[model samples]
Target: MGTGWKLYYTNDEYIDERSGRCPSTDEFMYYKRLDLCFNLNSPMTINFPVIKTFCSHMSAELIRIDSSDKQQFIEFITANETIERICIQGTDKIFPPNWTFDDGTLMTFFNEDEASAEPDGGKGNIEMYTGYKWHDISDVTLHPCLPICEII
Candidate 1:
């Protein structure tokens, strides 16, 4: 069997050979001061902002966060320097937590089959059809209508 790794943080002492659990703000500060981070373990339980801040500073590409914490994750990506990609998985949609940011670009990924065409009038201005009903691309396939703009 393969060994499991973990990132730990607690407010008290870290016992045994298991990953160190940060229990206090001071201990977390120590992690933040490190230049390089190496992980050899799973199931890291961190309950402090400092540790999370350190993880963000270490260029961790894959991070798992609580669905309810999506906004915080978004904030971290925008403010922190170490992260390159933030993937939100195990969900049915991209904006499930319903986070929004103005004056910044957000890339939303979807399956090719799930893509739908917009009306000619709505070209260059695409709004997600959350409140209104939308038909599939087939609805306009037979009409030879050229969209107002092309998205390349």
Candidate 2:
């Protein structure tokens, strides 16, 4: 027989059974400066389509770094999770080399090291490298990227 322990999802309408109040998860963190609640879930194989679906289920979306401030914030988020890479919101699938967010917004900011010839064309999805630079990665090896979500 299977173990009878209960489990909770990161997006669940969480309530502490003991205190009867919502409690933050070990992976939860929020910043009032940006008013963004972050979920630093452990790394897992991630792709845009599936991630989009999951975000909708949680009323969230993959993080988007559209400015220097946001780029720094994302860096902070990754540091807290100690992850090497995390999925972000951008894609060149529709227009190679020109990335856009899912909402059809033009991605005005970039943290990629242009000198490195980064964005080597990996399935058109964007990710944040440990160095805080942008890179296009394909989930070919089941890229173990973090699920960095921002609640709306």
Task: Give the number of the best model, judged by lDDT.
Answer: 2
TM-score of 1: 0.18
Error of 1 at 98 (Å): 18
For all predictions, the C-alpha RMSD in Å is: 18.8, 9.4
lDDT of 2 by residue, 1-152 (tens): 35997775653323221121212543445565565565656677766678766666656788777789778877765676756777888887766667888777788888885867676674777887748788887643466687677665
TM-score of candidate 2 relative to the true fold? 0.72
Measured against the true structure, the TM-scores of the candidates, in listed sequence, are: 0.18, 0.72
Q: What does candidate 1's lDDT look like per residue over 1-152, in tens digits?
A: 34797766764322221234332222221123212112211222222222234344543312222233433323432342332222221121234232221212242432222344422222111221222212222111122211111000
Lowest lDDT 10-mer window, candidate 1? Answer: 143-152
lDDT of each: 0.25, 0.68
User: Model 2: which ten-residue window has the lowest total lDDT?
Assistant: 14-23
The most accurate candidate by TM-score is 2
